[model samples]
Target chain A: MWMGQSSVDFIMAGCKLLDEGNVQSFLDNTDIVLTDCDGVLWRGNQVIPGAQETIEKLRKLGKKVLFVTNNSTKTRAEYVTKCASLGFPASEDEIISSSYVTAHYLKYIVKYTGKVYTVGPQGLAQELNAVGIPNFGTGPDVAENWKFEDYTTLPLDPEVNCVVVGFDKDFSYVKLCRATAYLRDKGCLFVATNTDTGLPVNGRFIPGTGTIVAAVSEAAERRPDIICGKPHLPIFDTVLKLHNVDPKRCIMIGDRLNTDIELAHNCGLGAALLVLTGCATLEEVRQKQSSNSIADQRLVPNFYLPSLAQLGTLIDSLK
Target chain B: MWMGQSSVDFIMAGCKLLDEGNVQSFLDNTDIVLTDCDGVLWRGNQVIPGAQETIEKLRKLGKKVLFVTNNSTKTRAEYVTKCASLGFPASEDEIISSSYVTAHYLKYIVKYTGKVYTVGPQGLAQELNAVGIPNFGTGPDVAENWKFEDYTTLPLDPEVNCVVVGFDKDFSYVKLCRATAYLRDKGCLFVATNTDTGLPVNGRFIPGTGTIVAAVSEAAERRPDIICGKPHLPIFDTVLKLHNVDPKRCIMIGDRLNTDIELAHNCGLGAALLVLTGCATLEEVRQKQSSNSIADQRLVPNFYLPSLAQLGTLIDSLK
Candidate 1:
């Protein structure tokens, strides 16, 4: 269903289905594999069939595997525990979560010394704490029985020099007020973990970190100074700093094209593999393929598979 | 500081200082005056000097006076009370607040029948109640000790077919979750009162309705179907339906350039007068005047005074 010369060129360049003819060369050319967790490995609590076997087979082939997720609600330690529980055994070093990257960016990259006013969950705060960065504002900070006028008089911490926004279940008007107030200084750095708009749950959706970040950005009248997440440069910078891997030999496999596939494109990775088991569809890939916009074109993946199970089957046939 | 021929033409067409040579003609051409409340008449509780006298003089000169405000936290009746207390006595019919227009739009314009899930204050609900529209979700709706998982399971009102977002002091994550859920249905209408980012309070700022709207928009992955406030046509449409004043004979005066000045430009009003007592400054007007962008040019006002006090002085000289 490719349309023109441009579409044909894009199809030939990417979005090809992994087949017997291409599987051997694809594996031979890739040394590092960065796989997104939420949709690729599992949908919520249930793991995708053969995902564990595919990862195991990749590891047995001497391919370095890393669980790269934009989910900022969990620390690397927490992700490791979750990964083990889900049948994909992983260590802290192999988990490149957004929270870990944010902490690493702040601690090592920015070398920030002042206190951080975080509008996030406990795990996000834990990551900051682990990096020895003073932070607060995790739990409910709602203004109970207080008028809008009270919010103006609410005392702000003078020590706060940074505001980090992530997935916050306890997000409230008061926290938004405080975040805006701190950001008014202009010296205070505004950072966001990720901008995933919604999280799918039980076939439904709940507001994600993007929603919280949007709220703060609106109030602050500014976009985030830095975003330590997929599709952004900070997370990739962290990956490069921590691990030695050739960019042209790295493959990123994710179910979402905007975040995972775009991340691969942004980082100049060798390949982006789209799996039909999650948020994106083959129809979407075709739509992007025909679009003239470079931004939309970048969402097109280099490879496609029905699921990782199919990849596992392909590998078994080769053996 | 005008740059090119276009800049000179823009300045000659608008952004002229209201002086004795122009005051009489400007006043004679206007049959109705639409004035913004927050920045123009008063900043917080204290009123701008001579603002009340200026309104009284406008009325004595046989001009219809209407208080137009983007603040959606107050009903028209409540606005009347606020005006009376502030010495610029006004009737409920003279008050055209965003909340009033929102209710009017949903009630008469759209002829909406289903229950409205509101994320605003008591005054917003009062406005909807006055129009006999069933609404809920005003006060604090936080997820006390519950996790993010609980938000996905939170019961949604089946009757809710519309989500109205406005200035809410008790805005919380649970409220955002519900709003996002209701807006997920493509059939459900999404409405916002206004998108004022922050309210300047006691020299500081508190997050305004825009922050909440931004959050909900991000989560829902869609913009509001309609916004009933300044610079948008819905509120002006409400004004036209309620009053017999001609657009060419009506003038809008305010302190903000984006909302107040832009509204006058959008409505084909006779003149837009800028008063430097609140949000905007003379420097901003110059910036807009010099900009080549048509959108920026639209923000430039027809006449400007240091404050309403200067307009009062000009009128006294004429008498």
Candidate 2:
């Protein structure tokens, strides 16, 4: 009955725990499975237990599995190689990263042919290069002898029509000024890889792309035209268009409820499953469920599992 | 009649053009006068036309005058020297800069003796030193080769209980991460000098202190506890306390409506005058006067003057 309605009520009503009985039911209708890489597949360098087995089992079952990640530090090719090295059945075509999705969006959806003023890393540059998007303002640290007047006389390329922001170790005041100057022209497209407030670094979180993006936004006093990442429609649409996913037959699995689960709901996917291996816990899921507001209710996932390790056992039972 | 009322209506009603007849009447009761330095006194290194003469005339009339500025790049002694060089009579006691006010607020109002984590220039460090506030997190450039793991394990002083942000030419990701980490304690005091979005550089504007402040705020997901700059009460209260002036007998004059004129209204000053010599034009003041909304109406200055040069003539005619 709730199959056609694209409303919050329909999504909330379908949320429950994915059990052994429901695993077969979920797999029967869902042909495509999208899972987040970092928390779901691996925490850092180490892989999550039984997660690789579940991905391999899904591929063996003729399921079109794709790895969707918001970590824009690595290009799509890097993600593919990293995934394979970790013993997961992965390829370049099956990896959908924020940087890659951003490139795809700029090339296909917007039909943007102009040069990009990028404030990001080499990985972002590589992805843009793959799609034939020329970029400037990426490398080169701010000069030590930079005067206040130099910013006014900044030599900007006239062909640059887009300002892209992402995670860059070399992010500096020069890059910030150039991006802000390009964005001062209201017609120029403003795009950010992801607005993840913090990124995990050695078991602790530090400032992420959002912090960099926020500085430009505040200086310009304007919001980005689009953010090509999770919880936003551009990245989800990018994956859907590339893979030709059926909304009612696709499921999303991740560890965080806000980004992974909310992204699933926003894209009108079949279901979203939350695991306890990431930022969210069981107590948080329960708290979100008890909340009456529509926004809080949206954070509620369709299913809860202790870990993706349980999915490997369920898939094994099928054999 | 509306001497005690703090409503926006009273402030808006008190606005009028400073004419020959009103000049004497306005000055008769007003003994203390505050003014912004950049566009009002001088634009860059050159002083405004007749600005020095007007300051001299006011002093001759035995009126107390103070220069209120948000430029945190220079110390109070530097400002006094710069003012004298520009032919404007000024002293350290007659200057109120954002850095000085920030130091005063921490030392007097908050009574905070703990060390500070500063993301700003040497001017701020000097002010903090003057007040005997031990500080860290300034002057040093970001490491040449910083890894993500370094941020998680970055060396931080335990005594640092306050995070101060201002215009820093040496601002970097390392400084942003350290400030965010210090602020993660939740008990740490977060203070910003000013939120000027852009600073004028040879006619064009570049990113200012607000841009740097915003990045830390976004990463920490918390607003600064105190912003000791124009339109904020702390700086205004600092000047009033240091000079022991009456708000009912004080007046503010500047070239911008937002920071300068708004500061006057917020402080319950007797009058505010807008001069068409800076960022704002005459048309903007007219539009604000015609606006129906209370917020917009507050932007309308009580009086409009072509320039401070005209005030010098009016003062001479009286003699």
Candidate 3:
């Protein structure tokens, strides 16, 4: 994923990159731009300026606009609310984040004859329910909801074909044990929402869905079939499908190399615009770019931007 | 996995079950009763009563005997040494187990490559060496010599077609990380020695090879392909292939049902005897039996005795 440039440098550098022209050859022909939310829009709650205006400009140009994120803690409604509060008018329909992507991914791969054993919050379940995927799991209202016995562990029947894992701070051992046993006996599939490892916010890093997923993975001996969210594929697919845009015309924008930049690299899409205000630094970006892990070709960012406020004037240059 | 049954009880029970009729049936007709050392003869050199005499009686009848254990924890020389000390006259040729089984299994599955990144002890390495399977692991005196980079956190790699997880207590985190990575990336095969969760000696429980194997399985999110030692198939297969004994005429005996009883159950061979002196109790045996977790409709022991020394009276009854 792209390690974002700071807002100031972002606008200045992005303008230069755009003005440098080959990039405009990129944006001018681009039909869809799947932007990540965590590091792109606002640091946490506050707007980074020009985020709304950029969305407006893209929409005014009749471009498909979708905010795909790996974070599933917030539901679609919360995302819309957050977008509105940040001056960008958003609807549940306008966003295709990891949370939503995971829900859709589940529909495509997980064959559910009955309710699914969900491990995320309302947005995820709602997305599943909207698709008529029966959400079979119980919540806190049903404490001890997940028991080994409650699961069809041994000689598992075909009624339950999938188990979806997401961010749940209080996940229990019983669920893990059941998953392990079920996978062991029946060989049912496993899928996770994302693999962000950890989420960074307000200068503090908390264990992301990846960490939680890894914990269960360490016990179950089965990696999820698909990591549905950002830095993976489902969200990107949904963005393109929903926008009806050719991937060649798509650009991914984000504030981190791990989430935003890596997504663009993995997917056959345009370069990322890494903003420095999020998770990684210039030094880290440079070091990671040279590392074999991310690969030289996979490391991307068409522009190094400090922030979006500077981009407003640059858009004027286009006129 | 037959638990708590002394090794001898395990044998007698398995012999009697498959033999049917009075105890005389086993004594009269049985030719070769191959025994795996890990869960069968002794866990790690503590004697299970009746093992020596039981083996002696069977040998006296001109039965060809082999001490097969999947555990590569000791070398052929070491096994012979251990057996001789236990009052069983064992030679390198007479002692056969998983190292031999795995070496053959490797040849049957994957052609002998240039080198192998072994993860067990000298016995395992020697077994492979004898079979012309080049050992790529470090020497015994090398002091934690296995390189950590060979393994990974994602246990998926096409290169790692087979991994042997035996007894390696100095298990560092790096080994686990690499093993996990290999399992995930390659979907590589894995082979375990035994499934005994814990080993007992001096009335204390010590984590056995199975515990370590479980950790690898957990980290890799993939179960090993075969548990090579007793109760699984490798050791038994070696004996059967070498001794020319029919499954019906054979009997398996061990302390743990997870291994010994499991072997008899899986093979449709002779009976399984539950002895209380080693791993599990008779009570557990009955419980597992009711659940059908134990093998079904095979040779089950016609008798459950604490030790095989009592077999003289049992033999008298047979007469």
Candidate 4:
């Protein structure tokens, strides 16, 4: 019997390492694969060894593969191009970035007509623009020779009725002040792409979109109206609507537990497969499994692999 | 009977409005007056009516008056200048700003000798410099025409072992990145001036130090080790050590209940007097008084006045 159709007992007994004993059954149950891009497929400009082959093997086995990322720094088109260059060979339609969901949510779900003041990057802005939504405030907007008093008289666009926050290298105090001013209006919408605190790159960390969102939330004294990203319902809902995939037949494969694996549990996916090519370690999985908290237990993925290379080797052995 | 010497019965009966019947008794019990500037004394460049006269009257009655403010944008010297210009005529010793408390705590309490990475204005840096602490990261540290990839290679000061956050108009992504990197070390110290979300200025609001702190905290994945501002013990402890005033004889007066009034209650001061020339309103006081939570009830001041002008009139009438 496919694990997707099995009882809740299988999910409860999570954190089992995938090998010859169970790799075939895991693949048999998963008809659709939602894979996180960064740690699973690539780290910075370098692609993880055998990740490309694993994704290809999954696709060849008739599994519908989708590239899912909490990163809002890149648009779907940009992601597609990057994926191709990195050997993942993805199409724009096969990519579901946080930025894409943000734009989709605003355009289709909210049906917003007003201008947006975005505290993000060119990719986020491009996503919004692709959906025919008017937006501004992407790059550096720092005031020259500014005083604290200048903030009081800072001119705000009267047309902006929404504020979108994401990852922006040019995030500045001026942008924070502007966002707070717009968000002060009760009717104005506050949308965040994701709340991932830090982005890990080549063994280093940089402040992520969540840092910027935290600042804006503090100043506005309010949380985001909607967050369209992993471990949150909005992104999953978007995936469900766009792909029309059965949740029971889907497995989310990623490296991080809190975001990728927790998102799998939150969305009622068939199973979550954790790979050790990124942030999480087996020690952490063991800790989560031993923990009594249900929230922590949910972060325990159904299967673990040393890396995507192990999955590729297992698939080759299946032949 | 002096309410300061009275039992818990007097404190339970908080939110009493000051009038002719109660004003004299309230003052007689208060040996030291801790008054907040901005809304209580002045708003922007304009001083509150009768505020100067009220301070004069308090001093003439032999009360030791000190200016207590959560604002970290200005140092003690700047505050003294601002006070004299606004007719309050305060000396540097009477000025207790959050910036001053931050420097005091780091120099005297933590006894930290490491270079500080500050995310604040010149005044905050000046205060730290005054205490012989070497610091940097003031003004705009933004990367011109920067890409997200540049943040990965962003150089961090190896000598910086502490990150002090306050209000900074020049706050940018580069500063947030660098702060996060330095804070990754387990031995690094994280300190914040205050957590006031917004600074209400002439019917408008600007982001405060707390906003910046929130960003840094989110990125660093830790709360400040010490927040040297209102409602926290640091600033009040500084006051007690430097001035040697009994908490039971010190009354806190301010426009905001959350910071000033809550600080008084937290420190077990004689009383908290709300002057409604600033952010808070009587309606809010009533709400806090009616709240079931002890924390909410703590925000209820012992007394309230329409403004300091009423207190001045009451003093003249007594004379």
Worst 10 residues of 4 chain A by lDDT: A1-10
Q: What TM value does the first chain of each candidate achieve?
A: 0.95, 0.95, 0.83, 0.94
lDDT value, residue B277 of candidate 2: 71
The Cα error of candidate 3 at residue B44, in Å, is: 19
Candidate 3 residue-wise lDDT, A140-249, digit = tens:
21213332123333233356566677764433333444444544433566777777655544443344566546645654555787788767766776665566665656
Writing each residue's lDDT as its tens digit, candidate 2 over B55-115 gives 8888899889899998988899999998889998688999999999999999998999899
Q: Which prediction has the highest DockQ against the true structure?
A: 4
Q: Write the per-residue lDDT of candidate 3 for residues B96-122, one digit (tens) a residue.
A: 666677776676545646445555656
Chain B TM, every candidate? 0.95, 0.96, 0.77, 0.95
User: What TM-score, over all chains together, does every model reach?
Assistant: 0.95, 0.95, 0.50, 0.95
Cα lDDT tens digits, model 4, B1-319, are 1223332444578688788898888888889999999889988889899999999999999999999999898999999998998898988989999999999999998899989999998989999999999999998898887766787787878889999998888999999999998888868999999989899876678999899999999998998999999978888888887986778888999999889988887788888999999989999999988888878887889899999998889998885
Q: What is the lDDT of residue B54 in candidate 3?
A: 68
Can you give the lDDT of residue A305 in candidate 2?
Answer: 83
Listed models, DockQ each: 0.72, 0.69, 0.03, 0.78
Q: What DockQ class does candidate 4 belong to?
A: medium
Could you tell which candidate, 1 or 2, scores higher by DockQ? 1
Residue B174 shift from truth in candidate 1, angstroms: 1.3
- Candidate 4 Cα deviation (angstroms), residue A315: 1.9
Q: Chain B TM-score of model 4, please?
A: 0.95
Native contact fraction per model: 0.90, 0.74, 0.00, 0.84
Runs of candidate 4 with Cα error greater than 4 angstroms are A1-10, B1-10
